[model samples]
Target: MAEQIIAALEKIVGANQVLRGDRAKPYLTEWRRAFQPVALAVVRPGNTGEVAALVQSCADFDCAVVAQSGNTGLVGGSAASDARRHVIVNLERMDRVREIDADNATMTVEAGCTLADAQQAAADAGLYFPLTLASRDRCRIGGNLATNAGGLNVVRYGNTRDLVLGLEVVLADGRVWHNLSGLRKDNSGFDLNDLFVGSEGALGVVTAAVFKLYDPVVQQVTALFALDAPEQAVALQRRLIAASGHNLTGCELMSRQAVSLACTHIEGCHEPFEVDHDWYLLVDLASSAQGHWLHEVMAQVVEHARRDGLLSDVVIAHDDERAAALWHLRESLPPAQVAEGASIKHDISLPISKLPMFLARALPAVREALPGVRPCPFGHVGDGNLHFNLSKPAGADDETFLAQSETAHTVVHDIVAEMGGSIAAEHGIGRLKVEALSRYKQPVERDMMRAIKAALDPDNRLNPGVIVD
Candidate 1:
């Protein structure tokens, strides 16, 4: 059966494009090396039609089909976590900027195009695609749509789902569904594009997408400030929004531990303040207005926040080079944590109002459970998401600390539940969080999601065991 399926895919994408054995090694490993993939074959489709045919072939063979994009997902969704010998269909060959309608402020791009490529394409046409992630240079647009990724700019431009106007998807049964409309106001029956945006390739394969664009920011200001606590960060956001309005494009917070680790482990990282503080916020404001008004407004907002006790100290950038340097502290955190040692990571979200309390309690509880455990809790505080990660104690056994991963997860998740937060935030529920989703989601909500899955992919051929029972 696997041979017949391979033959059918090879006929569609040529034998050279159908990879197995040594050639399949690259597609089998997750970005974080969390698991090993046991895929039957890695099929590289060049276009939407090829992807459609691959899906149909897998369905006919009664085999599972997993559609992968850049394979940069933190969760096990983008890679085959299970030992299932399913066929892996990756869109690396389908990369292309089909069209960029500058007049309509939209760009049509294939899923294989990297996020950075999409941003550059828009810039060439004097427009801007505002989906900015740390992995933008490597992460593809299709994968961004698949997980609805949120980045530093999400506080203003929103998630990948919000930037998309339409999608060109290949459904479970190999039928191509083309709804690549660029209209901003469509009173259609249902917003079908959204159904697949955050579906994580369970319902279908996102071959291409139509993304909304924005006017490029000509004036900007960035600063790094110290805050006493998470609650103060929230207070600062409120004050800045009131003063700057939509021009405030980015706001990121880092714990003192996260800052210390990043600065020490990652080179070229320097503290922006004269004295160390418990927390730090990286604030940025962008505008299309002319002159130096953007910087002036941001400086004024900082004074207001300080007056309200939301801000303790600040260092505003005087030039573009200085602004980029400030952003380096926030972007280099994840790699620094990895450099420290083996760690348990969580992509979770909570109400901004409860940010301070959740951190205040959860940090102490985890430290108590595993003495000397280093917790680096930081992320998009304005958007209510935190990358709550824990490093093993000094000179501890790696295998033993990882062995208690479940216990640590439970402790953190319990705190999240008490604060009415979600265990999975920007990251979707791939195989990694399927069990957690079942435990946290309401019974009715779970049933409804499963029903939709059953209706769309009746035979469960498309990325099975993800987001459903």
Candidate 2:
């Protein structure tokens, strides 16, 4: 059966594209190395037609197919994990810029285009694609669409799902479902494009996407501030949101431990001005009004925050170079934490109003449960999404604390659930948090999700064992 399928896939995409044995090793592992996946082969298809044909060949042999892009996912969904019974369908070869409808404020690009490439394409057309991530240079548009990725700009533009106008997908049976509509108000039917957006490749493979672009920012103002407490950051954020409105492009918070870790582990990242504080916020404000609009609003926010005793110290970027430096510090936290040691990570979202209360309760509970566990919680707090990751304390056994991950996760997730929050915020439940999803999600909602999965990929040939059983 393996020989037959390989031969058929080689015919669809060239023989050189059909990888086997050692050639398939690269495609079988995710960025974080949570687990190594075993696959029979990796097939690289150059276009939608080839992808459909490859999917068809897999179906013909009754083999499960796992779709891959820039395998940079934190969760294990980027590769198969059950056993060596899957065929990997990688989309890097299909990278292309099909069209840029700038007049219509939309760009149609193939799925394999890197997030950075997509953003650059929009910029080259004098527009802006607002999906920004640290891995933008590596993560692909396909994975971004499949996971409904959220990043720094979600408070302004929205998630990958919101920015997308339409999708070109290859279904389980290799039939192409092309709905590349760029209409702003298309209430014609069931909003079918949503099904595959955050499906995490459970239903189908996203081949290409029509993404909505917006007016480019003529000027941007970035600021870094030391906060007296985490709640102060929240209070200042509320005032800024009311005062600045949509001009507030991004808001992020880093706990003191998170900052120290970033400064200690990451090169060129350090405490600004040698000042010490309990928490810090990195704010990005931009305006299309061309002149002084960003400066006026951001200055007002900083002035007001200080008056309210919310800010301890503040530094506003006077030029583009300084702005880039501030952003680099904010983006360096994740890798810094990774460099420190093994940690249990949580990607969670909460009601903006309840963030302080959730943090107040969750922090102490987890610390008590596992005393000396270093909590490194940070992320886009502007939109209420926090990457609440925890690093093991110095001199602690990595394996021992990692073993207590379930306990640590439960403590945090329980509070999140009670506060009307989601356990998996920006990161999708890609085989990493499936049980947590099932536990926290209502049964009826789970049933509906399962029903959708059953209807679309009845054979479970595409991205099996992800998002759903």
Candidate 3:
């Protein structure tokens, strides 16, 4: 049966594209080297037709399929375990920017195109695809759509799901669902495109998508402010929202620990303020209007926050170079923490208002559970999502700290649940949080999700062991 399936896939997309045995070892592990899994073969299909054919072949042989793109995912969603029972369909070869409609403000891009490539294509077309994550250079569009990635610009442009106009998905049964319309208004039933956007390749494999683009910003301002506490950051966020309205683009929360790590590890990164505070807020404002004075608006926001005592010190970027440097500090937090040592990372979300309380409860509880653990919490606070990662104490053994991940995760996730938060936010519930979903999700909700998975992929051939059993 395995041979038949392999032969069928080879027939669809040449033998040269099908990697087996020792050749497929590289695709079996995740980017962080945290999870490794064996796969029968890693298949690279060049287009939607080839992907559809591969899916059909897997269905025929009752072989489980795992869709992989870029292999840059933090979660083990793309790794295939046990090759005898699993096959990896890598979309790296499917990269192509099919069309860029400047007038409609949309771009039709293949799933394997890098996020950086998509952004550059949009820029070339004099538009913007604002899903800018740190992994933009390596993460593919399909992976971003699969995860419904929320990045720095999500405060204004929304997530990857929001930016997508339509998708071209190859369903579990090898049937292609081509709903790639760039229409702004469609009262179409079900909106099936959304199902696969954040499905994590469980329901189907995304081959291509039509993404909504935005007018390039003519004026922008980035500012960093030191705040007394999370509450001050929240208050400042509200104040900035009221003052700037739609012009406000991003609001990121950074702990003193996060800032210190970035300064210590990331070269050319410095503290934004002289006096270190408990927390900091990185606020960005962008405007499409050509002559809009974003700098003046930013100045007003800083003045208001100061008068209100929500902010202690502020540093506004005077030019592009300064803005880039300020953003570098925030983006470097993750890598710096990694360099420090093994960290138990939690990408969770809660209500914007409940953030302070959530942190207040979760932080102390986590510390108590894992003594001397450093809490390095930071992320898109404006969108109510926080990374909430915990770094090991200085000189602590990496394996020892990682072994206690469950204890630390439970401490944090319990507080998040109490606040009606999601355990998996921008990052979908890949293999990492499947158990959490089973535990925290309401019985009926889980049943419904299961029903959907069963309905779409009855044989469980598409990305098995993802969101569903």
Q: Which candidate is the best by lDDT?
A: 3
**Candidate 2: stretches off by over 4 Å:** 82-84
Please give, for residues 289-335, the per-residue lDDT of candidate 3 as tens digits: 88757777778878877887888898888899999999999999999
Name model 3 segments beyond 4 Å from true.
none
Candidate 3 lDDT: 0.89
Q: What local lDDT score does residue 64 receive in model 3, on the 0 to 100 scale?
A: 84
* Candidate-wise lDDT, in order: 0.88, 0.86, 0.89
Rank by lDDT, highest first.
Answer: 3, 1, 2
Alpha-carbon deviation at 340 in model 3, angstroms: 0.7
Better by lDDT, candidate 3 or 2: 3
* Model 1: ten consecutive residues of lowest lDDT: 76-85
Q: Per model, how many backbone clashes are there?
A: 0, 0, 2
lDDT of 1 by residue, 221-248 (tens): 9988898888888887877777876677
The stretch of ten residues in a row with the least summed lDDT in candidate 2 is 77-86
Residue range 75-179, candidate 2, lDDT tens digits: 888768644458888999878878999789999999899999989988999999999999999899988988889998887788888998898999999999998
Q: Give me candidate 3's TM-score against the actual structure.
A: 0.98
